[model samples]
Target: MSQQVQAVIAPGENEPVRVETIIVPDPGPGEAVVRIQACGVCHTDLHYKQGGISDAYPFLLGHEAAGVVESVGDGVTDVAPGDFVILNWRAVCGQCRACLRGRPWYCFDTHNARQRMTLASTGQELTPALGIGAFAEKTLVAAGQCTKVDPEVSPAVAGLLGCGVMAGIGAAINTGQVGRGDSVAVIGCGGVGDAAIVGSRLAGASKIVAVDIDDRKLETAKSMGATHTVNSKETDPVEAIRSLTGGFGADVVIDAVGRPQTYRQAFYARDLAGTVVLVGVPTPDMKLELPLLDVFGRGGSLKSAWYGDCLPSRDFPMLVDLHQQGRLDLGAFVTETIGLGDIEQAFGRMHGGDVLRSVVVF
Candidate 1:
């Protein structure tokens, strides 16, 4: 049976997102239907609305979500009805070259529901934001997209593990490989940057410096485990970071802001043979200019982290357990909770830097 539910949709480029009736069809082979309990308002959703992601219009936006499994199609043995799960965009196909090489996290072929969700009034197929359209009351997705976790955790916090939170943490722990006593500097104290601080602390980093223009966000970074904060507006962050690390740049510098200037800051703010991780998404028109000699002289890796090189099956459950044990503070990331119709308002708040995350709770 096809279920008609209220969902948020971006009808066209630069159009405001609004709630409308949409038809979610029954799961086909290797698919599942989820009743979403909570979904976070991420910048990626905003990018989709602005047509920065693709030409796909009338996008069903929202991907960072947690919910209960309502039903499953044939051969969907990983999850069943009534199970609690976190929605993920990466659904690894074991036969892919990346997966066969034992790096399933880089799986080239990810799974999404074959069936399309259509607008109720127009009968037009709606493109999902990132293969998972989760702003709706109920959503259809690939069975592999559902990662089961303990039902005891709050859906708002757990949903974040699906996207930005995971990306930030993974940038520090998985991609940057922050180790004990290492000095780490994260540029941009947004949700992603703050998560890098927390992840660095969790990995036993001795000096964690956070750089951002907003003093309020810097304060929040301290609460998330930053040992020092640098207001980039007041001082040169590269010099500040170097001064804090005994006048030798940090062992690892992560650029979360993803602009040309920040990228250069991150490049120059690392010690010789130190790693620089670029986790920030850059615009297509942006061009980077670096000295070829410096690239050779730096002598360390310059890597771009895709989804933080994360393996969902391994990271999600472990992080949830850490949250349960009270070792990780997942709740700190959620600043507020809004309703389905309030996505536009939440986007404005995000743009204004008033909140880290404004989750929509069902």
Candidate 2:
């Protein structure tokens, strides 16, 4: 039987998301129905509402979520009913070229529930954001999309592993390969940037410099483990980072803002043979122009992180364990807890730089 649940939906471009009744169908083969316990409000959800992602209208906009499996369809054995899981967008297909090459994180094909949830009133099909529409009481997703984790953790904190937090931590640990005693600089101190700082610290980075235009964000970054903070509005970030790192540059520089200018800052603010990891999502029209000589002179890796190049099966459980052991402060990322109806308002607060994460808790 189809279940009727109140969900958050972006009806059109730049439209305010409304709480509407949507029909979630019974899970089919390889799928499961999840009773959402908590979902984090992320910038990506705002991008979806603003038509930045795609023209797919009436989008079901929440993705970073943790929930309990209420039911499973035929052939779904990875997860069973009553299991606590963190929803991940990337459900790797083991047969893909990337997976065959032993890098499933770059899986060419990811899976989502084949079924669609419809608007109960109009019967219009709702596009699940990132293949895991989660701002509802319950959602349907591929069984692989649900990674079972320790149920003792708070849902609000666990759900963040689904996206932004995972992206940031992965950018530093997996992509940048931050190591002990290395100097690291992270540009843009939002949730992602801050998480990178935390990851770098966990990796034993000796000098962690955070650069951001907002002093407020920089202050937050300091609490997250940054040893130094640079206000880009007052100084050149590349120069400041270089100055902080003995007139050289950081061993690893992460560009979390995903802007061309920030990309250049990261490119130039790295030591010789240092790594520059671009974890930020850039738009199509955005372009980068750097001197060919400078590119050669940098002599290091230039990489982009997709979902932090994280393998959900491996990373989520370990991170949760770290959080449980009090070694990683995942709960620090949760700035506020909100109801489902307040998601639209949370977006505005996010844009205004008021909170790190405003999670929707059911």
lDDT of 2 at 36: 99
2-95, model 2: which lDDT tens digit per residue? 9999999999999899999999999999999999999999999999999999999999989999999999999988899999999999999999
TM-score (C-alpha) between model 2 and the true structure: 0.99
Tens digits of lDDT, candidate 1, 174-220: 99999999999999988999888989999999999999999999999
Q: For model 1, give the 10-residue run with minimal summed lDDT.
A: 299-308
Clashes by residue pair, model 1: none
The CA lDDT of each predicted structure is 0.95, 0.96
Per-prediction backbone clash count: 0, 0
